[model samples]
Target chain A: MEEWLRGLRGMILESLARHGLPFPVGRDVCTGWAEGLGLARGGRRILYTSCMYQLYPYVKSVTGLLESLGVHRGGLRARMAARGGSLARFLARPSGRDVERSKAILRSIVSLLRRGGVEVGYLYEEEPYSGALLYELGLEDDFARHAGMVVEALAGRGVEEVVTVDPHTHHVLTRVYPNYVEVPFKVRSWLELAKPTHANRRVKVAVHDSCLYARFLGMYHAYRGLLDAVGIERVEDPYVTGKDTSMCCGGPIEAVAPDLSRSVAELRLRRLSALSRTIVVVCPICLANLSRAAVDVEVLDLAEVLG
Target chain B: MSWAEAFQRASENAIPRTGMVLEAYRYVVSWARELRKVKEEVIRDLDRYVEEAMSSLRAVGAKPYLARGAEEAREIVGDIVGKGKLVVMSKSMTAAEVGLRQHLEGLGNEVWETDLGELLIQLAGDQPSHIIAPALHMTREDVARLLRERLGADVPDDADHATLASVAARFLRDKFLRADVGITGANALAADSGALVVVENEGNARLTMTLPRVHIAIVGMEKIVPTFQHAVMQAAVQAAYAGLFPPTYMSITAGPSSTSDIERKRVSPAQGPGELHVVLLDNGRSRAARDKELWEALLCVRCGRCAFHCPTYMAAGPRFGAAPYAGPVGVMWAAVTRGVEGAGNASLLCLHSGGCREVCPMDIDIPRIIQRVKSRYVGRLLRTG
Candidate 1:
């Protein structure tokens, strides 16, 4: 492990343990998207954001801050930033514009689910971070403990089935959580539960397959099926969207190596822009990372396009 | 080239390769499963397999030597070749592992890597970016320049790939004829029959192993299989997943070549090399097999397909892993051969997207194992800190 990664790990673990989120952001940033959506407080089945989509904008901002600070180079400065050297101020808030953009995507997801005739409850501020980052960083012990906390929070709220919005949260809840913690709730992606009616408009978009959805959670067909059902024509290219060949959005390493992450995103974006000007993404991280690198292309969430 | 340019070129090269792999993937997947089982069984009792293989090699009249470390392996080959010998070598990760070429050269022997890509990298004095395609990072222009400068071959400024290949081929053909010794790596070693199987797309391996009077093979212990039939299956499975099914050539050598046609009686030292030496290089492989989290990595057949599909590998070129091992699987192999700390930074390049495991023929849980490697590295760091 590098010095900065160790420092960042310590900071993130402390934040998650203390505040139940990876950052020091407030509850409003998490539940604000559901403010006027008329979603119920809790139910047997619920829409679980896991705050990934909401938290990502903040993650994007902080990573940019870290990159600008040359934290990727790693040294005493990294340890100082980890100890809250103007970092807390950056992590304290995401830009209102970015927040609104993320909120609109979350809104689009809720609208799509509603149009699909699925009424679901939202946990709002009670929703816990999925600890997917912990799992990704090889912090299994911390992730296991965090998974227990997340499971307990959902179970206590009578949440029987989790309707996940993003692939990372979906995969962690469905495939990874069971290995670490005893889970009483059934987990499913909103893509599986939402049965949206056919769209009247025709559109062409390049669909970017999320690595987790395509390779791990097996939602490649489901998302493509949804696109087809909505009368959207996906510009297919093996190098861009092939199940085995599609590139990652580089979000996985954004925090540790933002420059490399941007490079990967640019590579993926180049493949996508060659096919279509409008790019559709299934994962929030993909949406964020690719959107950063996209110059002329419009990166939209699958829900934003479907709805 | 810049990382972006390198990444784009790699993607351009790998895209079609993956397409071809997908075409044969469904058919070869079952063979991959059985191959993994065979590898697991062999590694489980690797010591017994080593002894059995050595005995079988002796029975077949091939000298067998076990090297406990890289230094020992290099010294064993060095002593055999002596000084002032001309050597032709096929592309072998094991040979790279033990630094055999450098060591042999240090002993005052002339060595040439016969594979076109390996040769280009050797001329450039650069490490291999991808195992199968050593010079994947280099452009045709780059090769033309290297060949023109290093070999003084006649290559046009805008020479095509075929032109470039033929020029190198013509140059190496002379070296092959005059070579005093040939060194190669075995894809799989059959303990039952003492057969060494080498799979390749070019006929260079055949020439490198057969044209010389002394033939020496260096193989990692994890490459051992139970029988000759199993060894052939292993080669086929490796080639199939690498998107080259029905490989161009698979040479299965049980021992030194001999003729009995002279007097209806067995005769030694015939058309091929009169002597064959098999060096079984351990070099941390046996210890890796005993590691609970990492042993599955030994199941890798060195197909290099994972690098094709790995995002970081494609993006960073040789930067993603230790030399001679690249991509997701490379980090684990680096951990096995170079220790966990050596693999620490490289392992971090992995995105844990599960792409490598998804495409792996042996179905090795690459991400899980890398995480384990990462966790161990982190643990060691924290303890020391």
Candidate 2:
């Protein structure tokens, strides 16, 4: 998935340059304690928050690629238990190593962003994160304590925006966090941020609407409209579950129903094929699933299409 | 016929129990939100674009009249139509918004929709659900069935694609040759050159304008652009939005299809129409143009992209709204042109996705406009309450 995502990101960057649109690249930071212990220096952690993590091979591949790209492995599990539901408590078992690992990963991600010249911010007060585990471990205030240090560090560097793909992250930073951080922010999908620099010379394509975009974010048509403006002929995908009626990409259900997930992906690909030979997807999970399905069509991210 | 009577008849024919009205309202709200997000730079220069379009139309030897209302537009069209057997057309939702077809037909002339989709709709005895792709909801099987019923036993169910194409081709070819006049909607009209841009996959529009001796192009006043380049850009955007390969073909008719190729002295014997007429219908466009927020609805290129992406449209199919216009843009257009009471209620189900805005080449924020319409509807309800 990361291989594909990286390819998509590269395409978007190229397209943006071609179209004379703005493209900003930078680093981000998250400061939170796992279990009751703070993260030690030089520790490793695994981060799994996005629904995309449920897809095993794809997640493994993306994580491996990110690691190869110099990303640190920590125990930071960024997993969402349900759609807009609570974070998993099982991962919060008072194992000091687990906590330390999670923190290390978060720190590494932050460092990566900083190195890339991007600023970081945090909004970490929702769901189980604000519930009993941190409190039970008697380290409830550790998140705020560490977050303050990171925020201060970021402020001193004049970093303005904390770019995040998750709406929860955006909601926390913008609305929940009490830091009164006045930094202007951008909450967008990786595809939106990394649009290609080249004009789409190819005219015919179909967009497979992502559930996150259509259902949670209400952005089903915006992508289509943007593609249209960029001179790409958009064909209608009959199986698109738009907005409230959106169908899940089966990323979430993959843990319990892998076959069902694959079937859904196949069904979606078939519908998309009816529309066009080129299928442009917006979500990381959808890209992974459809790519794995081996559908005999060119699969691209919307940003890639723009390129 | 008065617009009031026409509207009454449309209301009677409307599938009142269907969910179209609610779905259309929802689309308006969604599109309105998107229009609001358009960059200020684009919104600020709208007047200039309008002026440019008006000038181009005048330059091409086409008259650009700004009618204040439907009644005024009726008088203008009535004057042009005269008593000489009113051969009518199928081109715009604006015509449907104002009920021009029935009115002209009532004035006692044979009216026909020459475009294959419009003709199919005419034969099916249905109203257009989308501004473009009017028959998008119908499958080939439905068309085959309808054709079989209309053409009788001679039409075969197992007929190949070529045979079916030849059938409709043969039927419309005769209609085109014999029609006294042809009417069409301008995708974009250059205000500076008075050139009319007609984009279509089929050659119906070309035949419609050229075959008839008297040619008429009807367009909303807002369809005007300042220059040919701007019109071309808009056309490209429309084609992209409509999901076609730059539209199967685009026809730019300046005056009529007259050519000097027939003679060395630059004289045409029988090529193109002798008289070309352009009707710049205002209907309720002027009213919409006055409101800064709702005015951008006039910028629609009638590409049908918004409807194509609309969730409600996908679920309810084309019959989801009132005649002439359907989907999100249609709801607002219907309201403005048809009346708030008559069409405002049609767009109650729109989800505020801001998708329509993102796709709009002109970047019209449709969701915001729909909200404004909803507010007006709410205010009216309050007043009555």
Candidate 3:
């Protein structure tokens, strides 16, 4: 490991330990999205966002600021940047519009589940970050500790089934967490749980599959099924949207290599835009990263598109 | 060309070819599954297979030597070829693994890479950028310039692909005619029949081995399978998954050419190479096989499909891994051949997209292996720092 990535991992573990999140953002940002959704709290089944959807806007701002300031190359500057916690809190804050958009997408997911007769609750502040970044970054020890805390938090809330909203969160809960800890909850993606009535809009859109959802989690068909039920005609190319060949938004490398991440996202956006002006994504990371690169095309969440 | 520019060109040209392979042979998926099982069976007891293969080769009059590591393998080969011999080589990643070509050249031997892509890479004084297409990073324009500059072959600055190939062909035909030793990497070595299988698109490998009086094959221990049928299956599966299905040619050589044509009695040096030598290189492969999850990497057939599908690989070109080995599978190979530290921080470049595992014919869990490497790398960093 290089000094920069090592320093970044150190800083992230500290943040996760101190603030219960990867950033210094408070619990309000994690639970604020469910304000008027009228969902129950402390129930057996809850909609677990894993703070991915809420934190993505902040991720966008922070990665942009770090990239522009040339903090990607680690040393004194990067270590200094990581230690400037207060400044990060200010810079990591999402805009008012971005906050509302995040809330709106979550609200749409709840509504779709409700319409499909699948009533779900919200964990609010009790929901823990899935510790996906910890696992993905290869901090297995830290991830194991964090996953233990998350499982404890969910169990305290009497949560037995977690309906996840994004691919990264859904994947950690469904596949990765159990290996590190005793996961007591049943993990399900909203794509599998939601069955909203046909919209009959008959609109054509390009779908950007989440690498986790499409390949690792076996949810590719489920996502396409959601689009079909909503009456959206998917315009796909074998190279662009092939089940095996779909491109990534490069979210996984954003923290370590921002410039390369942006270039990859731009490339993916270009291929997707050629298929349709409206590009739909199933993961929050994809939505954030792709939305950053989207100029002429409209990048929307599958939840937003479904609503 | 820069890494980014090369990535763009390679992806533009490579993606469609893979798509065509996938569409043309839907049976490739089932074939890959069968190959995976066979590879798993062989890797389960690699040492046993090595002993079986060595004895079988000896029985067929082909000398087989198992070199414990890279230095030993290089030394053995150096002693065999001696100094001032002419050696022409077919494209072999295993040869690149032990740095054979440079070693032979270092010993005052004339060495030429017969594969067109490798020949270009050799002429350019560059390392191979891809496993199958060694000079994939170079465009036709780059090839024209290299031929014009290094070989001083008469070629237009804007020569087409065929013209560039012909110039290389005419240049290499002479080397093939006069070469004393032909060296190659085996695709699969059969322990049951003492056969060496090679899958190729061009006829260069066939000529390289047959025309020379001395033939030496450098093989990795992992290329061994139990039977001749398994070896052939391995070749077909590798070719199909590599998007070069029904590979234009496949050569299965069991031993040095001999004939009982004269009064039903065998005679040596009948045709082809009078002597065949097999050098099996371990070089940390057996050590790698002992690892819990990393042992899965030994089953890889080097299809190179994983590189085309990996975003970081497409963006960084050869920068993603050590030379000759690049992309996701390259990370594993580098970690094996070159220690964990030698693999560098390139493991950080993996996105954990899980795309490589999906495309892998061997069903190796590359993402898990990469995570393990990252974990180990970080652990080493934490301890040493």
Candidate 4:
């Protein structure tokens, strides 16, 4: 194994050690607020963050780990490819207003579900990653072990259902988790959980479908359903949208081969930015990566638009 | 060329064609299930079907041979079609797999690739980029340049395709008549009836199969189906996936064209070829078919839609394939037929988008297949190192 990939793996394992997570525990402050709300936990829904939005705060650590291992940086694309593997994409740390924006979106989702007469609770810092990276990178044995631990943890909470914020997590929990071990709890994308409430924001938005959500979860129309309910005008790239042909956000492999990821992101954003200045992204990784790559476009979480 | 650059170049030609195929595939959505069942049955019991096909073809006076691997298949082809003869070939991905064209040419036969795309690729001294449209990576400008220099045929630098095709057609038609042998790869072979089915849009396959004195079909062992009806249905799957309702022509060869109409006597030298030989090439397929999941790839009808819809394949084109195979199924095919390293490397090109599965008529679950292959290959490499 390459020295850097091994080192990056060590760093991820360290995350699990320090915070019972696979990413840097960069202060999940929203979980504290959710805990204080004392929302009924036994009431059918457990709000799961997938730790992606929290990982947003620590994503640079993977790159920092890469440079520390002497993997030289170049341009954005070349530098990404220099990292040698996909271990780094675990962090899609949101920045600026996006952090506060991301937290607000999560808070709004809980409130929206609450308004709809549903109960929501958090595992706080105890939430583990859905082990999506391990599964995706072909570390199935590791993922299987991790998934067992996760199922045990979630099950111990007496959790009846899971409200996942990210598509990768939603897919792993819904689709992948069952194959390894029994997932007794029902997993739903937060988009499925949150009913629309007026944000008083009336602007055109392009819907950038999460490949995991739209293609894997068969949620192509589900987002449109959510968007439609929000009473917002949403635009879709005709060629790249729909159930069969939705384009990827290029965030999945950002750490494995940065250049390829960049090129994919550039092409996708170029096409998307042509349609609308503000695009509604479905996953935090999608929001982080696309907003980073956007030239003159605003990338927002779907919940952010609704909130 | 770099894989990314190649895909960018090829997609200009591929994307529109894929759009058309996706549209056509919607109409035949029902066939995918039927074809999947047929592929499962035929592939799971492939060896038994091969034996049945061998017996059935032999009974009809057509010689059949089961080759263990690529070398044996190439040697069999070599022995049958000897030196100092002109050979014309139809478009065949299997032929590409064993390097048949290069092997035949090395054996002193003047082989004229008859398919228009194959002919252009042959003239250009380039590798075939697509299963059906072999020269899809080449622009008209590239084709014109190659024709002008290699074929020495007068074609303008910016001349459109039709004119360039006509010049090549005139040159190839003469070779077609004089060729001593013709060769093709079967889309599917009917084990029960001893029939060889070849589907193509061009008229080349029909002429190649019938015109020569000796006709040879080099087919993968897995192409065997239980019945003629099954073979035709598989052909429909292939055509539909290629974005065609059906090819312009379908040629079903039932032994050599023999006639008993003349005075109650069946002639030895029939209307078609006096000699008909079917080479069932295993070429690691027997080993692959034993693999519980990898074998599903052998049941693939080579629709090209999986590759067509793949984002990596769209970005990388033929470069996305390892050997003769490309795209998602290509990764599996390459891993089994070629070697693990290239296939493992090519596997990374895929984004795990699941777009191919959505379009796959068979619902092959290609992401899982690629991942499995990658896991095995990486394990082997680490152990060896």
Better of 1 and 4 by lDDT: 1
- Candidate No. with top DockQ: 3
Query: Could you give me the TM-score of model 3 versus the true structure?
Result: 0.96
- Scored against the true structure, residue B192 in model 4 reaches a CA lDDT of 92
lDDT ranking, best first: 1, 3, 4, 2
Tens digit of lDDT per residue, candidate 3, span A83-144?
75643665656777777888888888988898889889887786788899888777778888
Query: lDDT (0-100) at residue A74 of candidate 1?
Result: 80
Q: Mind giving the per-residue lDDT tens digits that candidate 2 earns over A1-307?
A: 2222223223323422342111111111122432223322211111212221112233323322333333111122211222111211221222344234334433433443344444333432211121111111112133344335434544444434434443333333443345333433333433233333344557588777765466435556767765775678777633343342233343322222234345445555655676777887665455555665645887665544554
Candidate 1 error regions (>4 Å): A198-202, B1-30
lDDT of all predictions, in order shown? 0.84, 0.52, 0.84, 0.74
Task: Write candidate 2's Cα lDDT for B184-206 as tens digits.
Answer: 77777765677788787778887
Docking class of 4: acceptable
Q: Cα RMSD (Å) per model? A: 2.3, 16.8, 2.1, 4.0
TM-score, candidate 4, chain B alone: 0.93
lDDT of each residue in A1-307, candidate 4, tens digit only: 2332334345556666666666554446335445456665444567888767755434433433433433323344333433434433534433455556656767777877776666777777666678887777655666788899999988887888888888888888888888899998888777666777775469988888887877777788877787788788977655656555556666665555445555667667876787888888888777766765678788877777774
Ranking by DockQ: 3, 1, 4, 2
Off by over 4 Å in 4: A1-11, A23-44, A57-98, A236-238, B1-27, B339-342, B379-385
For A72-187, candidate 1 gives per-residue lDDT tens digits of: 78876677776764787888666777788789888887887887788899887778899998888767777888899899999999999889999989888888899988899988
User: Which residue ranges in model 2 land beyond 4 Å of their true spot?
Assistant: A1-307, B1-59, B83-90, B158-161, B256-270, B319-321, B339-343
Give model 4's TM-score versus the native structure.
0.89
* Residue B339 displacement in candidate 2 (angstroms): 5.3
